[model samples]
Target: MTGVVGPGAVWLVLRATVLVVVAALLQVTVAADLEVLDGRPDLVVIAVASIAILQGPSAGAVAGFAGGFLVDSLGLGVIGSTSLTLVAVAYGVGVFGEGLRRTAAVRPLLAIGAASLAAGAGQLTLALLVGSVPQASPALALAIVPGAMLDVLLAIGLYPAVRLLLRRRGPRTVSLDLGAARV
Candidate 1:
Protein backbone atom coordinates (compact mmCIF):
# COMPACT_ATOMS: atom_id res chain seq x y z
CA MET A 1 0.00 0.00 0.00
CA THR A 2 1.27 3.46 -0.84
CA GLY A 3 1.64 5.65 2.25
CA VAL A 4 2.61 9.16 3.12
CA VAL A 5 6.37 9.09 3.42
CA GLY A 6 8.41 12.22 3.95
CA PRO A 7 7.57 15.78 4.96
CA GLY A 8 3.77 15.36 4.91
CA ALA A 9 3.96 12.30 7.12
CA VAL A 10 6.41 14.05 9.39
CA TRP A 11 4.19 17.11 9.68
CA LEU A 12 1.16 14.94 10.39
CA VAL A 13 3.05 13.12 13.10
CA LEU A 14 4.27 16.37 14.62
CA ARG A 15 0.80 17.91 14.58
CA ALA A 16 -0.80 14.84 16.09
CA THR A 17 1.89 14.60 18.75
CA VAL A 18 1.48 18.24 19.70
CA LEU A 19 -2.29 17.90 19.76
CA VAL A 20 -2.25 14.81 21.98
CA VAL A 21 0.25 16.33 24.39
CA VAL A 22 -1.62 19.60 24.72
CA ALA A 23 -4.97 17.86 25.11
CA ALA A 24 -3.68 15.49 27.75
CA LEU A 25 -2.05 18.29 29.70
CA LEU A 26 -5.19 20.41 29.55
CA GLN A 27 -7.26 17.41 30.59
CA VAL A 28 -5.10 16.72 33.61
CA THR A 29 -4.68 20.34 34.64
CA VAL A 30 -7.65 22.45 33.57
CA ALA A 31 -10.54 20.07 32.91
CA ALA A 32 -9.80 17.89 35.94
CA ASP A 33 -10.76 20.69 38.30
CA LEU A 34 -14.01 21.70 36.70
CA GLU A 35 -17.23 19.89 37.56
CA VAL A 36 -20.68 20.11 36.09
CA LEU A 37 -23.29 18.13 38.00
CA ASP A 38 -20.53 15.93 39.36
CA GLY A 39 -19.22 15.30 35.86
CA ARG A 40 -15.90 16.42 34.50
CA PRO A 41 -15.49 16.78 30.76
CA ASP A 42 -12.77 14.70 29.15
CA LEU A 43 -10.79 16.76 26.71
CA VAL A 44 -8.67 13.79 25.77
CA VAL A 45 -11.71 11.91 24.54
CA ILE A 46 -12.77 14.93 22.54
CA ALA A 47 -9.31 15.30 21.08
CA VAL A 48 -8.98 11.63 20.25
CA ALA A 49 -12.43 11.48 18.73
CA SER A 50 -11.84 14.64 16.76
CA ILE A 51 -8.57 13.34 15.42
CA ALA A 52 -10.08 9.97 14.63
CA ILE A 53 -12.95 11.57 12.73
CA LEU A 54 -10.72 13.97 10.90
CA GLN A 55 -7.69 11.80 10.24
CA GLY A 56 -9.13 8.26 10.14
CA PRO A 57 -8.95 5.14 12.37
CA SER A 58 -5.21 4.54 12.61
CA ALA A 59 -4.46 8.13 13.48
CA GLY A 60 -7.41 8.22 15.86
CA ALA A 61 -6.29 5.03 17.59
CA VAL A 62 -2.76 6.33 18.01
CA ALA A 63 -4.00 9.66 19.31
CA GLY A 64 -6.37 7.88 21.65
CA PHE A 65 -3.65 5.65 23.05
CA ALA A 66 -1.24 8.55 23.47
CA GLY A 67 -3.71 10.91 25.10
CA GLY A 68 -5.15 8.18 27.27
CA PHE A 69 -1.72 7.15 28.48
CA LEU A 70 -0.87 10.68 29.48
CA VAL A 71 -4.14 11.13 31.38
CA ASP A 72 -3.87 7.77 33.10
CA SER A 73 -0.31 8.47 34.10
CA LEU A 74 -1.22 11.85 35.52
CA GLY A 75 -4.47 10.85 37.26
CA LEU A 76 -5.43 8.17 39.74
CA GLY A 77 -7.02 4.92 38.62
CA VAL A 78 -6.25 1.67 36.85
CA ILE A 79 -3.15 2.01 34.67
CA GLY A 80 -4.35 0.98 31.21
CA SER A 81 -8.09 1.41 31.56
CA THR A 82 -8.47 4.83 29.95
CA SER A 83 -5.97 3.97 27.27
CA LEU A 84 -7.79 0.81 26.36
CA THR A 85 -11.15 2.51 26.20
CA LEU A 86 -9.92 5.52 24.23
CA VAL A 87 -8.17 3.36 21.68
CA ALA A 88 -11.29 1.40 20.97
CA VAL A 89 -13.58 4.42 20.95
CA ALA A 90 -11.33 6.45 18.71
CA TYR A 91 -10.91 3.66 16.21
CA GLY A 92 -14.61 3.01 16.05
CA VAL A 93 -15.33 6.70 15.61
CA GLY A 94 -12.75 6.94 12.88
CA VAL A 95 -14.24 4.02 11.01
CA PHE A 96 -17.68 5.48 11.37
CA GLY A 97 -16.51 8.93 10.25
CA GLU A 98 -14.93 7.60 7.09
CA GLY A 99 -18.33 6.60 5.67
CA LEU A 100 -20.06 9.92 5.84
CA ARG A 101 -20.38 12.47 3.06
CA ARG A 102 -18.07 15.40 3.63
CA THR A 103 -20.93 17.88 3.62
CA ALA A 104 -22.87 16.16 6.37
CA ALA A 105 -23.26 18.28 9.47
CA VAL A 106 -25.12 16.44 12.22
CA ARG A 107 -23.30 13.18 11.67
CA PRO A 108 -20.02 14.31 13.17
CA LEU A 109 -21.88 15.46 16.26
CA LEU A 110 -23.53 12.07 16.45
CA ALA A 111 -20.16 10.42 16.17
CA ILE A 112 -18.87 12.56 19.01
CA GLY A 113 -21.88 11.66 21.18
CA ALA A 114 -21.41 7.96 20.51
CA ALA A 115 -17.71 8.20 21.18
CA SER A 116 -18.36 9.98 24.49
CA LEU A 117 -20.86 7.35 25.61
CA ALA A 118 -18.64 4.51 24.53
CA ALA A 119 -15.58 6.00 26.19
CA GLY A 120 -17.49 6.66 29.42
CA ALA A 121 -19.00 3.18 29.43
CA GLY A 122 -15.75 1.47 28.50
CA GLN A 123 -13.77 3.21 31.26
CA LEU A 124 -16.51 2.73 33.84
CA THR A 125 -16.79 -0.93 32.99
CA LEU A 126 -13.06 -1.33 33.28
CA ALA A 127 -13.11 0.39 36.64
CA LEU A 128 -15.83 -1.97 37.79
CA LEU A 129 -13.96 -4.98 36.46
CA VAL A 130 -10.91 -3.96 38.46
CA GLY A 131 -13.08 -3.42 41.57
CA SER A 132 -12.17 0.24 41.57
CA VAL A 133 -15.66 1.71 41.54
CA PRO A 134 -15.89 1.43 45.31
CA GLN A 135 -19.54 0.32 45.47
CA ALA A 136 -22.65 0.05 43.31
CA SER A 137 -24.06 3.54 43.47
CA PRO A 138 -25.30 6.44 41.36
CA ALA A 139 -21.73 6.75 40.21
CA LEU A 140 -22.75 5.04 36.98
CA ALA A 141 -25.27 7.73 36.10
CA LEU A 142 -23.07 10.52 37.39
CA ALA A 143 -20.06 9.28 35.54
CA ILE A 144 -21.63 8.62 32.15
CA VAL A 145 -24.53 10.98 31.50
CA PRO A 146 -23.35 14.38 32.58
CA GLY A 147 -19.86 13.67 31.39
CA ALA A 148 -21.13 12.54 27.99
CA MET A 149 -23.25 15.68 27.81
CA LEU A 150 -20.27 17.83 28.55
CA ASP A 151 -18.20 15.94 26.03
CA VAL A 152 -20.70 16.44 23.22
CA LEU A 153 -21.16 20.09 24.15
CA LEU A 154 -17.48 20.70 24.13
CA ALA A 155 -17.06 18.81 20.89
CA ILE A 156 -19.53 21.14 19.20
CA GLY A 157 -16.91 23.85 19.51
CA LEU A 158 -13.70 21.87 19.55
CA TYR A 159 -14.38 19.39 16.73
CA PRO A 160 -14.62 22.17 14.16
CA ALA A 161 -11.33 23.61 15.33
CA VAL A 162 -9.71 20.21 15.04
CA ARG A 163 -11.26 19.76 11.61
CA LEU A 164 -9.76 23.05 10.48
CA LEU A 165 -6.40 22.22 12.01
CA LEU A 166 -6.21 18.89 10.24
CA ARG A 167 -7.14 20.10 6.76
CA ARG A 168 -5.25 17.95 4.31
CA ARG A 169 -2.59 19.72 2.27
CA GLY A 170 -2.81 16.81 -0.18
CA PRO A 171 -4.69 13.54 0.03
CA ARG A 172 -3.01 10.70 1.83
CA THR A 173 -4.29 7.15 1.72
CA VAL A 174 -5.69 6.89 5.24
CA SER A 175 -8.86 5.00 4.25
CA LEU A 176 -10.41 3.50 1.14
CA ASP A 177 -12.56 5.88 -0.83
CA LEU A 178 -15.08 3.60 -2.45
CA GLY A 179 -16.94 6.54 -3.94
CA ALA A 180 -13.88 7.81 -5.72
CA ALA A 181 -13.67 4.81 -8.06
CA ARG A 182 -16.88 4.66 -10.07
CA VAL A 183 -17.34 2.26 -12.91
Candidate 2:
Protein backbone atom coordinates (compact mmCIF):
# COMPACT_ATOMS: atom_id res chain seq x y z
CA MET A 1 0.00 0.00 0.00
CA THR A 2 1.22 3.50 -0.81
CA GLY A 3 0.88 6.38 1.57
CA VAL A 4 0.48 10.04 0.67
CA VAL A 5 1.61 12.40 3.38
CA GLY A 6 2.38 16.09 3.92
CA PRO A 7 0.83 18.65 1.60
CA GLY A 8 -0.16 16.07 -0.95
CA ALA A 9 -2.39 14.29 1.53
CA VAL A 10 -3.98 17.59 2.50
CA TRP A 11 -4.71 18.38 -1.13
CA LEU A 12 -6.17 14.91 -1.62
CA VAL A 13 -8.45 15.36 1.35
CA LEU A 14 -9.58 18.76 0.15
CA ARG A 15 -10.27 17.45 -3.34
CA ALA A 16 -12.28 14.56 -2.00
CA THR A 17 -14.27 16.85 0.26
CA VAL A 18 -15.13 19.12 -2.65
CA LEU A 19 -16.16 16.20 -4.81
CA VAL A 20 -18.46 14.76 -2.16
CA VAL A 21 -20.00 18.12 -1.34
CA VAL A 22 -20.70 18.92 -4.98
CA ALA A 23 -22.26 15.50 -5.48
CA ALA A 24 -24.49 15.98 -2.47
CA LEU A 25 -25.56 19.36 -3.73
CA LEU A 26 -26.33 18.01 -7.19
CA GLN A 27 -28.21 15.09 -5.69
CA VAL A 28 -30.48 17.32 -3.67
CA THR A 29 -30.95 19.74 -6.53
CA VAL A 30 -30.74 18.53 -10.11
CA ALA A 31 -30.73 14.74 -9.66
CA ALA A 32 -33.66 14.85 -7.29
CA ASP A 33 -36.01 15.99 -10.03
CA LEU A 34 -34.86 13.39 -12.52
CA GLU A 35 -36.45 10.07 -11.68
CA VAL A 36 -36.53 6.84 -13.60
CA LEU A 37 -39.37 4.44 -12.88
CA ASP A 38 -40.01 6.11 -9.54
CA GLY A 39 -36.39 5.78 -8.55
CA ARG A 40 -33.91 8.64 -8.30
CA PRO A 41 -30.23 8.48 -9.05
CA ASP A 42 -27.94 9.00 -6.05
CA LEU A 43 -25.06 11.24 -7.01
CA VAL A 44 -23.54 11.04 -3.55
CA VAL A 45 -23.34 7.27 -3.74
CA ILE A 46 -21.67 7.42 -7.14
CA ALA A 47 -19.19 10.02 -5.94
CA VAL A 48 -18.30 8.11 -2.83
CA ALA A 49 -17.80 4.89 -4.75
CA SER A 50 -15.66 6.64 -7.34
CA ILE A 51 -13.41 8.16 -4.71
CA ALA A 52 -13.15 4.95 -2.74
CA ILE A 53 -12.08 2.88 -5.73
CA LEU A 54 -9.53 5.48 -6.77
CA GLN A 55 -8.17 6.17 -3.33
CA GLY A 56 -8.53 3.33 -0.79
CA PRO A 57 -10.69 1.95 2.01
CA SER A 58 -9.92 4.64 4.54
CA ALA A 59 -10.53 7.45 2.11
CA GLY A 60 -13.64 5.71 0.86
CA ALA A 61 -15.12 5.35 4.33
CA VAL A 62 -14.42 8.98 5.11
CA ALA A 63 -15.88 10.22 1.85
CA GLY A 64 -18.90 7.98 2.26
CA PHE A 65 -19.55 9.25 5.74
CA ALA A 66 -19.26 12.87 4.69
CA GLY A 67 -21.45 12.43 1.63
CA GLY A 68 -24.07 10.44 3.47
CA PHE A 69 -24.20 12.90 6.31
CA LEU A 70 -24.68 15.72 3.86
CA VAL A 71 -27.51 13.93 2.13
CA ASP A 72 -29.19 13.08 5.39
CA SER A 73 -28.90 16.59 6.69
CA LEU A 74 -30.15 18.14 3.48
CA GLY A 75 -33.00 15.69 2.91
CA LEU A 76 -34.00 15.53 6.59
CA GLY A 77 -33.88 11.75 6.82
CA VAL A 78 -32.58 9.78 9.77
CA ILE A 79 -29.33 11.54 10.57
CA GLY A 80 -26.94 8.65 10.53
CA SER A 81 -28.78 6.02 8.52
CA THR A 82 -27.40 7.02 5.15
CA SER A 83 -24.02 7.62 6.67
CA LEU A 84 -23.88 4.13 8.09
CA THR A 85 -24.98 2.49 4.85
CA LEU A 86 -22.56 4.51 2.73
CA VAL A 87 -19.65 3.73 5.03
CA ALA A 88 -20.07 0.02 4.46
CA VAL A 89 -20.57 0.38 0.73
CA ALA A 90 -17.57 2.63 0.25
CA TYR A 91 -15.25 0.54 2.36
CA GLY A 92 -16.35 -2.64 0.62
CA VAL A 93 -15.78 -1.12 -2.82
CA GLY A 94 -12.40 0.16 -1.77
CA VAL A 95 -11.34 -3.27 -0.62
CA PHE A 96 -12.57 -4.79 -3.84
CA GLY A 97 -10.63 -2.22 -5.84
CA GLU A 98 -7.49 -2.99 -3.89
CA GLY A 99 -7.67 -6.63 -4.96
CA LEU A 100 -7.68 -5.78 -8.65
CA ARG A 101 -4.83 -4.99 -11.03
CA ARG A 102 -4.01 -1.35 -11.64
CA THR A 103 -4.81 -1.55 -15.36
CA ALA A 104 -8.37 -2.78 -14.88
CA ALA A 105 -10.15 -0.24 -17.05
CA VAL A 106 -13.65 -1.43 -16.39
CA ARG A 107 -13.25 -1.58 -12.63
CA PRO A 108 -14.90 1.82 -12.09
CA LEU A 109 -18.08 0.84 -13.94
CA LEU A 110 -18.30 -2.54 -12.23
CA ALA A 111 -17.60 -1.00 -8.85
CA ILE A 112 -20.26 1.68 -9.35
CA GLY A 113 -22.93 -0.90 -10.22
CA ALA A 114 -22.07 -3.10 -7.25
CA ALA A 115 -21.89 -0.12 -4.93
CA SER A 116 -25.25 1.21 -6.09
CA LEU A 117 -27.00 -2.12 -5.49
CA ALA A 118 -25.29 -2.55 -2.14
CA ALA A 119 -26.19 1.00 -1.12
CA GLY A 120 -29.83 0.49 -2.05
CA ALA A 121 -30.02 -2.73 -0.08
CA GLY A 122 -28.29 -1.18 2.88
CA GLN A 123 -30.66 1.79 2.86
CA LEU A 124 -33.69 -0.49 2.64
CA THR A 125 -32.43 -2.69 5.44
CA LEU A 126 -31.72 0.32 7.57
CA ALA A 127 -35.14 1.79 6.90
CA LEU A 128 -36.69 -1.50 7.96
CA LEU A 129 -34.61 -1.54 11.12
CA VAL A 130 -35.55 2.03 11.97
CA GLY A 131 -39.25 1.30 11.51
CA SER A 132 -39.48 3.98 8.87
CA VAL A 133 -41.08 1.63 6.39
CA PRO A 134 -43.95 -0.60 7.47
CA GLN A 135 -42.72 -3.52 5.41
CA ALA A 136 -40.76 -4.48 2.35
CA SER A 137 -43.45 -3.86 -0.21
CA PRO A 138 -42.85 -5.04 -3.78
CA ALA A 139 -42.68 -1.55 -5.22
CA LEU A 140 -40.22 -0.35 -2.63
CA ALA A 141 -38.09 -3.46 -2.97
CA LEU A 142 -37.96 -3.21 -6.77
CA ALA A 143 -37.20 0.45 -6.67
CA ILE A 144 -33.65 -0.46 -5.77
CA VAL A 145 -33.04 -2.03 -9.17
CA PRO A 146 -33.94 1.09 -11.12
CA GLY A 147 -31.85 3.25 -8.85
CA ALA A 148 -28.91 0.96 -9.43
CA MET A 149 -29.41 1.14 -13.18
CA LEU A 150 -29.51 4.90 -13.09
CA ASP A 151 -26.38 5.03 -11.02
CA VAL A 152 -24.51 2.85 -13.50
CA LEU A 153 -25.67 4.98 -16.40
CA LEU A 154 -24.52 8.13 -14.66
CA ALA A 155 -21.20 6.55 -13.82
CA ILE A 156 -20.54 5.76 -17.43
CA GLY A 157 -20.06 9.45 -18.03
CA LEU A 158 -18.94 10.52 -14.56
CA TYR A 159 -16.35 7.81 -13.94
CA PRO A 160 -13.88 8.95 -16.57
CA ALA A 161 -13.89 12.49 -15.24
CA VAL A 162 -13.46 11.24 -11.71
CA ARG A 163 -10.62 9.02 -12.82
CA LEU A 164 -9.02 11.96 -14.50
CA LEU A 165 -9.42 14.27 -11.50
CA LEU A 166 -7.97 11.68 -9.15
CA ARG A 167 -5.23 10.66 -11.51
CA ARG A 168 -1.79 10.66 -9.95
CA ARG A 169 1.52 10.74 -11.78
CA GLY A 170 0.70 8.28 -14.55
CA PRO A 171 -0.10 8.11 -18.22
CA ARG A 172 -3.80 8.21 -19.00
CA THR A 173 -4.81 4.93 -20.59
CA VAL A 174 -8.21 3.21 -20.41
CA SER A 175 -9.42 0.21 -22.39
CA LEU A 176 -12.58 -1.84 -22.22
CA ASP A 177 -11.73 -5.52 -22.68
CA LEU A 178 -14.67 -7.89 -22.72
CA GLY A 179 -12.33 -10.79 -22.15
CA ALA A 180 -12.34 -11.79 -25.82
CA ALA A 181 -8.71 -12.87 -25.85
CA ARG A 182 -8.02 -16.07 -27.74
CA VAL A 183 -5.28 -18.26 -26.38
Candidate 2 lDDT by residue in tens digits, 1-183? 136655566667777789999999999888889988767899999999988888888889989999999999997788889999999999999999788765566777889889999999999999998898879988887889888988988898887788777766534577777689633
Tens-digit lDDT string for candidate 1 (1-183)? 014465677777777788889999998889989998777898888889988887789889989888888888887655677989999999999899889765556788789888988998887778777887766667574668788888888888888888777665786556656897843
- Candidate 2 off by > 4 Å: 169-183
The models' CA-based lDDT, in order, is 0.82, 0.86
RMSD of 2: 7.9
Q: What is the lDDT of residue 158 in candidate 2?
A: 87
Best candidate (score: TM-score): 2
- Cα lDDT for residue 112, model 2? 89
The lDDT leader among the candidates is 2
